[model samples]
Target: MPAADWRMARFAPHRTAVSSAQVETVVARAVGIFGLVFAAQTVPVALEQSEALAVGAGTTLMALLYGGVVALAVASIGKVAVTGTAAAFAVLYAAALAAWPLLVDDPAALGGPPWLYYLANVATSAAAIAFPLAASVAYTVLVPAWYGVLRATAPGGQADTLLATLDALYAMILGFVVLIIITMLRQASRAVDGAQDAALRRYDVAARQHANEIERVRIDALVHDSVLTTLLSAAAAETPEEQRLAARMARDAVRRLDEAGASGPRTVESVGLTVLVRRIRAALTTFAAPFTVRVVNAAGVELTVEAIEAVYSATVQAMVNSLQHADEAGRTTRRELRVRGVGTGGVVVEVADNGRGFALQDVPNERLGLRVSIEERMAGAGGTAVVTSWPGEGTTVTIAWPAGVDGATT
Candidate 1:
């Protein structure tokens, strides 16, 4: 069969698309953006007025401090362990925000009470999705708290203590807002993945249940058409010759029961065309009328156990009917069974007999031997059976499997 049909037969399970990009990617990008923002805005402000911020603190130390944050971000971008590096950077960045005041060389570089610089850290910490919501909120609050402490304790910061406290509270509130928003999106993604997985599981369960129902129906039909027919024939015996025929029918019933038990629904597989034909011939040995079997253009093709059983049982029933009814005038009948492989991996078999045939429409629905036994049984196995007859020509029962049904699907 084609690749497309095979995929339709077997489907892959659901998986989360969110995991395609690792969580580390989010952390790296956030850190990279934060570092860029810091370098672009704060670096110039700190070094303005002829490197005023680096007066007491050497330019080398200030440059190294900014470079450190950038280095951590860059390091986390590579194949390094994500959670460890992110945690380490987040923890140390808190310290860096706290130590900014100590690194200020000129008093003028304290630049707006020195406490408000931590606002930028709040935004950066908010971007760290790897951190738990609580941890992120804590980091947001911690950065500002460190700034507040240093500013309140600094010599000239005593009068601006209230302003420093307000800055810290503002940063804490904004940090939590960012955390909640990101957390909600993450939860939504997880919920979507869960729903998709649940739906796929339900589909698998439904498919299994449907297959089981079909199997049950097929088994019931086989029992009705094959088993009951034999029993009826055995019960109707009248003479020594008839008794022998009935005994053969009884033995056929026993053999069919054994085959049914041995070839269980779960353990069966696709059988070779020749093997199936041989089995059919053996199955019909009990029939009083002899049937010649032939195979044509059927090399390297296979039939599903279900399809095989369906065709075999239905064809046997057809032959039995022909022997019993086709030659009502007491004339010799000729029976032919043909199996062929045609099209793309397709199977076609015909049970044709050279006997007086009856009109098709005259068969009643009450007699389920043809409809239920042959037609319904074949349909269940994903195949079709068609019967044609006339007053002069013999009846032909054709059984076929579609072009792409290569074998039984387990």
Candidate 2:
């Protein structure tokens, strides 16, 4: 495995602890099953070897010792101590196999229990399979090869040939199983790395979208609170002088908006309502005729970002609508655009004209300029759009929204 793959495999349990625990449980169960197999074979073989009772006893003792180690490994599950204990068991089993001939002089005459050797071989093979990489390979390969050669060279009895053949088969099978396990672990490691990479990409996309939305809200708020508010306030002014001043402010606002283009909204740390309104009004005045704007009651009100954007968009749409549908025959040089801040937490903006107006009921659904631009903007801010007009009396488009619906203002 590559270094990166190895590192990820080593630390995978930390990322998902529950999955790690489950894997440990599975390994423990496998170890326990191997121990049971060893015990069943060893106990029966011990009874059959009467002439070599000492050898049988010694083999039984070795089996019991290794069996205890396997039990401890399963009981602890995933501890470093399990590895140490398994290593010790592997050493003892290998030593017992090496000394088997000396312990049992003539096994064929006494129906030489080759089952004991087979049991020992299987137990040791399982230990090799369970141990970590380098260690598992070392034990599985070296011990079996050494025993096969020694037994072939000095056969103790008639059953020695059968024992040697079984040992060789066990060694080959164990080696193959280990290779398969390592291959599976490598594949699992790659899969985990791919999943993590995909997750990171999704997070990046979400973060960008969130940032864009925040910026849009900020710009909308600045335009509504400052420019649109001033335009609406000036429309309702009782004096000609106040009206003229408001008109100039609105003109300047339009100019600025055109220059800013659609760079999208930007969030600001702090904004003064009065100053922002002045800039907006100035920008609006620069737009063409039939697009009049008036700001009313904008003096002493505070608003959240979302509400401000809602009002700005609605007012802009209303002005655009008037400019588009205004009748030139009636000499309605400018449309009446009124934006009013009502109560402590709401705003009402109306755009009307003295020109010919269409029937509201007959308006086509495809004409969503007004629907999406005006109605949808307010609706998003938890507000509504009210339209009241006749064929002769012209049209009045009003948008209202409650303040503080978006989020807390700082």
Candidate 3:
């Protein structure tokens, strides 16, 4: 992939230009804000009927219901308290309905539909937002049916049976509409979230493959232009001067090879640790397996090109080593990467895994992965790598530059 496209995939924006989470937030806020309006409309009716109901019961019911509405409205700005407040109001409204008869001193004194009628939709709407689909559906149906029953009774102003049934149908229709909209929005948002996650995973894999191909090309070029040329020059050497020159060429090739192993394509520039941290994080995402990552105060440190190359290469190698070797029969391994800034301007990266480890001393000389790729690579760039491992415990590779005074760990 082109750099631009890869970067676009890295962030994984939704295709519709609006994320599902954002849509859900908008819905929540809309419901919450509209709930406030409904609560405001009920205040006058509540005040008018206060004398007909028990003082304490009516006061407590109104206070809790209004308080829950206020909380829902405040939480509309974020997700923190929306569900809790919404659920509370849904139940509180139902309680107020059930107690309406007992609280009222005389049902005959009530002159209109009653303050509870104004809030019927509000409660069901809250339930739609907070409860599961089945529960919300039930609330949508039952709240209206209960209200219709109350409306047909003496306390509900003794309305005609047909009129009460119409009122119940109207409330149910509105409640179901709200419930359907919320459920659909939630389902759509969840789908968007899943797509973004899958897109990011694919991007990670593609990026890693691209990086590996680039490294392969670099190695092939070095073998053809540097290593092979040195070999041909040595074979053709006849005189002392020719032999000495071939030997010098061979030495130069080895140094170049070491430099190649130590870092990426050569550069004399420096970069902040923050950029290095980002690269490491991006690299980690490419792995099909999972691992915990912790970064602490790694932003401010400055590193020369050589040091950055060494640290990055060694850190990545450490993780690769863990992936390849950290496993046990019938046991799951846990791996972690921690990057942090140390005293003054130094940086440290630690890769650890709890797996079936081997004694460091048992590693054979032919296996240069640890000795050459990581340890010597760091040393060539004026850094250090300390690898610790023991049988049955785990392995930890700590790579540090400007060699350490231990830094903070996350």
In each prediction, how many residue pairs overlap at the backbone (N, C-alpha, C within less than 3 A)? 0, 32, 0
On TM-score, the leading prediction is 3
Alpha carbon lDDT at 364, candidate 2: 91
Report the C-alpha displacement of residue 186, candidate 1, in angstroms: 3.3
Candidate 1 vs candidate 3: which has greater TM-score?
3
Question: Please, what are the lDDT tens digits per residue for candidate 2 over residues 72-188?
Answer: 456545444554565566666677667666666555544543334554444454464357666666666777666665555432344366786676667657655754564465456
**Which is superior by TM-score, 1 or 2?**
1
Q: After TM-score superposition, what is the CA distance of residue 52 in candidate 3 from its true location, in Å?
A: 1.6
RMSD (Å) of each candidate, 1 decimal: 25.5, 28.1, 9.6
Model 1 lDDT per residue over 1-410, tens place: 35475345544432324421234356456655666566566655455422434455535544554665565566556534545655665665566565555655565544445423533453345335557766676677667676666666542244366876886677667666666656665676556545544554464455556556656777788788778887887788789898898788778877877777554443123444544565566667888777887776554565554565677778778887777778757667788888887742568878898788888799898978888888877776667778889987888888777523433221
Of 2 and 3, which scores higher on lDDT? 3
* Displacement of the residue 354 alpha carbon in candidate 2, Å: 85
Q: Number of clashes in model 3?
A: 0
What are the runs in model 2 whose C-alpha is more than 4 Å off?
1-25, 50-60, 63-66, 76-80, 105-110, 113-116, 119-135, 150-157, 160-163, 190-410
What local lDDT does model 3 show for residue 405?
44
Q: Given candidate 2, what's the lDDT at residue 96?
A: 65
Model 2: weakest 10-residue lDDT segment is 267-276
My TM-score estimates for the predictions, one after another, are 0.42, 0.40, 0.61
217-281, model 3: which lDDT tens digit per residue? 99899989999999999999999999999999999999989888766533233445755675677
Query: How large an RMSD does model 2 have?
Result: 28.1
